[model samples]
Target: MSDADDAGHRRAGRPLETVLTRPRITAAALRLIGATGYESFTMSGLARSLGVAPSALYNHAASKQVVLQWLQDHVMTMVDVAGFGAEPWDTALRRWAWSYRDIFATHVPLISIMAVLPVTGAPQTLRMYETVAAGLASARVPTAQIVPSIVALESFIFGSAFDVAAPADIFETGALAESSPIFSAAVRQGEQIQGKARADVAFEFGLEALVDRIGRLRRP
Candidate 1:
């Protein structure tokens, strides 16, 4: 073909080539989810968001589950696991727990889905796990306990992420305060605490306890 013909052909194929990458697809999927929410998210909606046909999206991601896996992996990259090897195990665990909670605080919609998502094909997710597991092992945690320890930390982190997004008055007793004086008093005391947000305070409390408990799991 002539140079001009070759240029035309390349130009014709540019739309799909430019927009159909895994990154692009994942980005579009996130945008769609953010706009319409996970419940409303669909492959057709994702395709429309990217200005492509559903078939094109399907060509890259075989199913919605595949796209979700892509998103899970992409989000996992944001979690801070660097401290695992560089810092003491407890310090690394604290840093990772805080970072995980903060990152997922804005991504609460994905929490339920990711809880069940397997790490089999997700490299970034697997890498995060490997780093954490290795860190715990290096701390001398028993081999059989590593996975359970990680799961325990994750359960706390995920729950705290949801808590981070909760309303400031979520626990406000309001009209029920009179009948629930003790609980209401504690809530008032919590509100009176200075500096850190209530969520941060609660998370710190829980994380410190977990870190201390897990640290004890270290083998002699």
Candidate 2:
């Protein structure tokens, strides 16, 4: 599915308040950035990708910086989409984490851009802020504890998916049949698990860890 497919919400036509908020524009920019990467990302390039003339986009955003700002907002919105699944507060967090990771994993090009980029005033950067606020307001978690707990868990799941998608080096390795039987068996079955199955395995593993992390967070 397209990135726009994942945008997941919309208002009919344009609203007078703003033709495009930072988040909406950013979501579009993300599709371009993810598809083309920073090196290829330019205002003209984005316009073409969106099937609009370059100037048309200008009505919504003025510059690449503006587009970038919107993209940051869009990233944060992924959290909102995560919330749509709506389980209990704690359960929702896992579903949220999995949704976040899955969304990013599906858009690897954007993830690559985000790796070194520091997210500033983008709408979504306030994710932890919002989550913690909601947690506190809802009395689901404590002021002293929520921040680090979310950060640690978020980083772990994101990092795990990245490892699966773009391993530091997939080329270097030999089977350890005796020392690591599971690893050896995986090596043998490796070809069978190639293609979408491998991706599903990676995705499911990440999802399980993400959802199960709730128990860990609540424990010590």
Candidate 1 Cα lDDT to native? 0.86
Give the Cα lDDT of each candidate.
0.86, 0.58
lDDT of 1 at 141: 95
Model 1 TM-score, all chains together: 0.85
Residue-by-residue lDDT tens digits, candidate 1, 86-131: 9989999999999999988978877877898788877888999999
lDDT tens digits, residue span 1-220, model 2: 3436334323444433234445445666777776766677898887676666677778767888667656644665665434432446655665666667776665554554554455455436666557644753354454556666666665765665565576533632464447777766675576565655454566666566644554454533
- Per-prediction TM-score, please? 0.85, 0.56
Which 10 residues in a row give candidate 1 its minimum summed lDDT?
1-10
Model 2 misplacement above 4 A = 1-39, 47-66, 80-86, 112-120, 127-129, 136-140, 167-220
Shift in Å, residue 54, candidate 1? 2.2
Clashes of each: 0, 4
As a whole number from 0 to 100, the lDDT of residue 58 in candidate 2 is: 82
TM-score of candidate 2 against the unseen true structure: 0.56
The numbered model that scores best in TM-score is 1
